[model samples]
Target: MTALHCDGSLTADRASYGGIIRDDNSVLGMELLAILRGVTLCIQKDLLRVSIRSYSKLAVDILNGIVSCPWSLQALKVRITSLMEQLQRKEIRHVWRELNQPADFVAAIDTGDGESFFYPPDFPLDLVELIKNDSDRKTYFRTPSH
Candidate 1:
């Protein structure tokens, strides 16, 4: 099962969820990502104790197609309305793919395998470590001068 985390959460208790839904349509990557965001947000809502206030952010690293494709664009808009209506405020932003390697890897596996694959939360320790190491390297290099 895939683990979903809430990026806007401050508590350690906020990140507990797992599930995989097969996508038979082989939807475009951006569209799939959009759907994942919506589903994850819905799950997040269930896990949280209180309502999420305005300005909560959901960052994603995806193609411009999310906004460029009419169908995908509309589908994504609908996801928020239908799935996230309970939340008072939220923001979704597209980040650089390099900053979101783990998520990219997960999506790639979903598409490349052509079949859904679920694993324990710690199943891919190596991959998770690689992402953590890359993030640390970037942080080190980007550290501000004294």
Candidate 2:
């Protein structure tokens, strides 16, 4: 199974959303966008079984139909639903932000360019370290940002 972690960050100056910069200020919108992009990438890579993790409980609930999707996000909801149907198996779960640091870091990065995917050798060193720590089940603390 392929595991995908996703996140979105909104700051006073700008928003780094779903691997792209957008004028939208809604953090929820950004979270949904990140999930959409992650799922889309999974499909493109022919990953049929996937586990998607997000720190937004609302986003997870909305995607799982546990909560109603807002009217503004109906289109995105529909698209995500359609894409999910193509998967052989899937699990969408809400996790603590600490457990999702790699994705959070990626979402916070503003490259000014659109989506980016990094493979081994080309992966950012910081990200690689984070992934290694996660895989090793090492514990770390993150100070909450205002």
Candidate 3:
């Protein structure tokens, strides 16, 4: 249930990085819902790009349903509806597990039950290194920089 994010600009700089630890794990639907909720909190802008590792097909369907016709049990409708409205411009895609190892590592860390944490821009050295490697790996598709 941990969330990490960073934002910086030419004149000013900012970073929103944190992690949330749930008490325990559950089914795939609940897990996906929890992660989505965490991600919504981390967003700083109207547009967002997301990459997921588990339950790829299910995740895509859920997200698309939110944008198109959001329907869920009474208990979950509010959260899903809110997220749909909040996300004005977004792209959600499933990626290889190897590609998301860093995020998985962060989420897997034990931050204590119901505990949360935040880090500076350069914190989590291991995760940063993984990101660098993934960006450079040839098997990972990349478009030339403009």
**Best-performing candidate as measured by lDDT:** 2
- How many clashes show up per model? 2, 0, 1
Model 3: residues with Cα > 4 Å off, grouped in runs: 1-25, 43-55, 66-74, 120-122, 137-146
Q: Considering TM-score, where higher is better, how would the candidates rank from best to worst? A: 2, 3, 1
lDDT of each: 0.47, 0.85, 0.55
Error of 3 at 1 (Å): 24
lDDT of 2 by residue, 1-146 (tens): 22344578898998775643443226678898898888999999999899999999988999999999878888988988889999999999998887898999888778788877767788789999889988999886678789
Model 2: residues >4 Å from true position, as ranges? 1-25, 140-146
For candidate 3, report its TM-score.
Answer: 0.54
Question: What is the C-alpha lDDT profile of model 3 across 1-146, one tens digit per residue?
Answer: 53334444453466444554432223344646655665666565434554334434455555556433223433453455466556545555666667777667777878888846556584478877877887888365556679
Ranking of predictions according to lDDT? 2, 3, 1
In terms of TM-score, how similar is model 1 to the real structure? 0.44
Which residue pairs does candidate 2 place in steric collision? Answer: none
- Higher-ranked by lDDT: 1 or 2: 2
Residue 140, candidate 1: Cα error in Å is 9.3
Give per-model CA RMSD: 16.0, 9.4, 15.1
Which structure is stronger by TM-score: 1 or 3? 3
